[model samples]
Target chain A: MKLYDYVRSSAAYRVRIALNLKGLVYESVPISLLEGTQLGEDYRALNPTGLVPSLAIDDQGSGEGILGQSLAIIEYLDECYPEPALMPATPLKRARTRALALQIACDIHPLNNLRVLKYLTGELELSEEQKTTWYHHWLKQGLSPLEQQLGGDDSRYCCGDTPTLADICLVPQLYNARRFKLDLTPYARLVAIDQACNQLTEFRQAHPDQQPSHPGENLTRR
Target chain B: MKLYDYVRSSAAYRVRIALNLKGLVYESVPISLLEGTQLGEDYRALNPTGLVPSLAIDDQGSGEGILGQSLAIIEYLDECYPEPALMPATPLKRARTRALALQIACDIHPLNNLRVLKYLTGELELSEEQKTTWYHHWLKQGLSPLEQQLGGDDSRYCCGDTPTLADICLVPQLYNARRFKLDLTPYARLVAIDQACNQLTEFRQAHPDQQPSHPGENLTRR
Candidate 1:
């Protein structure tokens, strides 16, 4: 297996954590979003959306194909290798877990994504202050509800005692939130989950700082 | 089953199509997003994110247990009633199906969502023209790539001959594109898939105009 990844991308970070949790060994092929390499013709052929974290599976000893979307990729990994399941066995539990994941992946992440921010600052000509405000506004809209969803549970992870899809989505979003300097004190359960996840080798190894594309500087901050 | 829905919500529309496809009888409890009904305290308790298209399952003779997120709801329905599968049988194909769905559900729709549009025009005070531009910009970013992904496939639907999660996503987006007056000539395959999907009774019944909240008016324009 091979993963086309970008260091700072939250979507790519999700796939990285899933891979680590499944104990799958794969080569990381960095596709730098900052360098405009993802927009290149060659990379676009592999992934039409020109996004990071496309997993190329080598099933049948011959390459099957590449898959995109972080949640889809994570679910694929879970289905293909089911030992330590990333989703619950029951239908309703699975739905709840996926709902939590989608709350972050769909509602939250896209609003403040890199391209959206670029458009705000570049095309919209938003000042740095306005851009920061935009980022914070969307981040809070997403995190407040997410904080509530994860609050009532007394589990070790976001959905349960073990890490599920919700936790996979949460760690990366929190990582991005910290980078944007969003106040983390209000989201107690999410913060606790982040702390718990980072304690594990799977989550620790997949940190953005540990990626090949990291610039030898710590991107994560308290 | 009872579905908390809004007529124009792409997320809700996806679940409606999934339910119709599965031949499940569900009562539509209209949650009028435009009327600010989703912001109510009671609805928020049922759905922490305060989003539409929450499927409340009435299993075990109990009145309800709410399930949120369209993909999660569809997956739950697929799991509980598996005759007409919304996802593919194999992992790789399922991954492909989900990737297409997420590309729209996560990347495309959210950026141009009703709430996002309101935020743009209300909070940011963007002009109507600027808001339209923002909507078109994100829509194009998503659809152009999706067209490329679907172009090579000769499948009747987005993933294959059978209607899958991708088809469910495509129909609503195309419906939305028409509403926004986006030039649809470019995405022939997608347009064709939308046409094919609408021909089925399942997709026909799930049309936004057929929903209870639709004010007996055609929202889509050529």
Candidate 2:
């Protein structure tokens, strides 16, 4: 298997976490969003969306296919290899878990992604402060509801004691939230959940800093 | 079942379509987003998120519980009553349908929703033209990916001949796209899929204007 990935993309970071959690080995083929590799004709042919973290599965039995959408990829992985299940057994529980994941993945993170922010300042002409406000608005809007859900019934992980789909989505959003310097004090439950999840080797290895092409170390300005 | 819904909300429209398709008789309780009815104390008690299309199922034998998140609500409805299944049988196919749905629901519609657009122009101070551009940008970004998937499959519906999760999601989004005056020519495959699905009676009854709160007789705007 080969993962076409970008380190800073939270969606890609999610697939990386899932692969690590399952102990699956894959070759990394870097597709730098910053360097415009995603816009190249070769990459575009592979993915019409020109999105990263496209998994090229080369298993002999199943034949070849390129899978997109991080949640869909994770769900497919869970179905194809169900040892350490990312989703729970019951239908209601699965819906809740998926809903929790979507709360962050859909509601919060998409508004603040690289392309979206670039569009806001570049094409839409939003000022820098306005752009920051746009980012924080979604962060606050979604985190409040998510924190309530997590604080209500959650213990260690989002659904239960073990990490599941909700936790898979939570870690990546928190990674993005911290980068934007958004205040997360109000979401104490989420903050606590994120802190615990980060300690595990699966998550630690999949951290943005641990990526083979991490640009944060040498080039990032303080 | 009682549905707290608004006539024009795309999220609410998705739930309405699912209910009609499943042949569930749900009582209508309109909470107008335009009039700020969702923020009222009565509605907020039912849904802390203060969003509409919150379904409360009241069965004589089974107890009532509030279901939120249009996709979650639809999935739960499918689970509770499984005769006319919305999602596909196989996990892979189901993931494909859902990935297509999320491409519209998560990536496109949220960005163009009333609240977000209001924030964009009001708080972020984007001009009217910029807001229009912002709306079209996401609509184009999301629909183009969907076009490729739908074009490849060429199913009568998004997955197969029968309407599934993808159609349920697509119809509502296409409704929003049309409302925004977006150029649908770029998404020819998606437009074809939506056109075929919208011709159905289930999709017809679920149209926004047919809802309890729509202002005019015809759902189509002048």
Candidate 3:
């Protein structure tokens, strides 16, 4: 498998975590979102959506192996490699887990993604301050309710003892939140869960900073 | 099962289509998005996210049956009542189907949802024309790629002969685009698929105008 990835994309970060949890090894083909490589014709040919973290599996029968969308890719991985399950056993529990993930994936992340941010500052011509306000607004709108939902739970992860899809999605979103310097004080429960997930080798390995294409590497080497 | 729904919410509309496809009888409990009813304390208690299309099931063991997020709720219904499955059988096909669905759910619909539009006009103080531009911009960005992806497909539905989750998500999003007066000329394949899906009794029943709470009713009566 070859993963067309961008280090800073939360969606790519999600697929990385899922792959690590499933103990799968894939060659990382870095598609730099910062350099606008994903929008180039070559990447668009591979994945028409021109998105990062598209997994290309080597299908013996046919050459068509590319898959896009982080949740879809993660769910595909979980379905194929079901030992360390990323979902709950029961239908209701799975629904709950997916709901938590979707809360971040659909409701929050889409509004704050790099493309959307660019649109705000570039197309809409919002000032930098206004952009930051937009970022913080969506984070609070999403994370506040999420914090409330996960508040009373004593589970180690978002859904249960094991790290499920909810945790996979939450950690990246929290990472993005911190990048924008959003205050994390209001979401203690979510913060704690993020911390717990970060302790795991799988989650730690999937951190954006750990990726080969991360921009922070040059400064660190210096 | 009881569905906490809003007439024109694309997310809610997706679940309504899924329910109708599965032939499941769900009482529609209208939570008006236009009236700020979804953000009220009562609705928030039912769904901490305060989003519409929350399904409340009568679980035999406990009263904890409220489920949020349209895709999660639809998946739950598909699981519990699997006679006519909403997902493709194989993992790869399912992933492809989900990728198509998420393209709209995450990429397009969230950008143009009622709340996000309100934020653009209310918080960002964009002129109504700017808000419309933002809406149309995202629709083009998302739908162009989707059209390219679905261009050569000969399937009756988004995935296959049967109406899958992809179709369920697509119809509502197209409905939203049409509502915004988006020119549908660029997406002939999608428009044809939408037309094909609308011919079904299930999809027809799930139309916003068919809902008891739809604002269009009074005008029709007059």
Model 2 / residue A99 / CA error / Å: 1.3
How would you encode candidate 1's per-residue C-alpha lDDT over A107-209 as one tens digit per residue? 8999988888889988888899988898898889889998998888789998788999999999999988888889999999999999999999999889888
Residue A17 local lDDT, model 3: 95
**Which scores better on DockQ, 1 or 2?**
1
| Tens-digit lDDT string for candidate 3 (A1-222) | 888987778999999999999999988888877788999999999888877879998654556689999999999889888989999998989999999999999999999988999899998888999999999998999999999999987999999999999999999999989888999999999999999999999999998778855555323221
Tell me the alpha-carbon RMSD of every candidate.
2.2, 2.6, 2.3
List the DockQ of the predictions in order: 0.87, 0.51, 0.86
Per-residue lDDT, model 2, residue B217, is: 28
**Which model scores highest in DockQ?**
1
Pairs that collide, model 2: none
Interface RMSD of every predicted model, in angstroms: 0.8, 2.2, 0.9
Alpha-carbon lDDT, every model: 0.88, 0.81, 0.89
Query: What's model 1's lDDT at A110?
Result: 92
| Candidate 1 whole-model C-alpha lDDT, 0 to 1 | 0.88
Residue lDDT tens for model 2, A1-222: 888888878898899999988889988788888877887889878877777768887544656777777888898888878979888876667777877887777778777888888887888776889888888888888888788767876589998877887899899999888888999889899999998899899998888788756555323431
User: Candidate 2's residue-wise lDDT over B30-55, tens digit each?
Assistant: 88776789888898777767777688
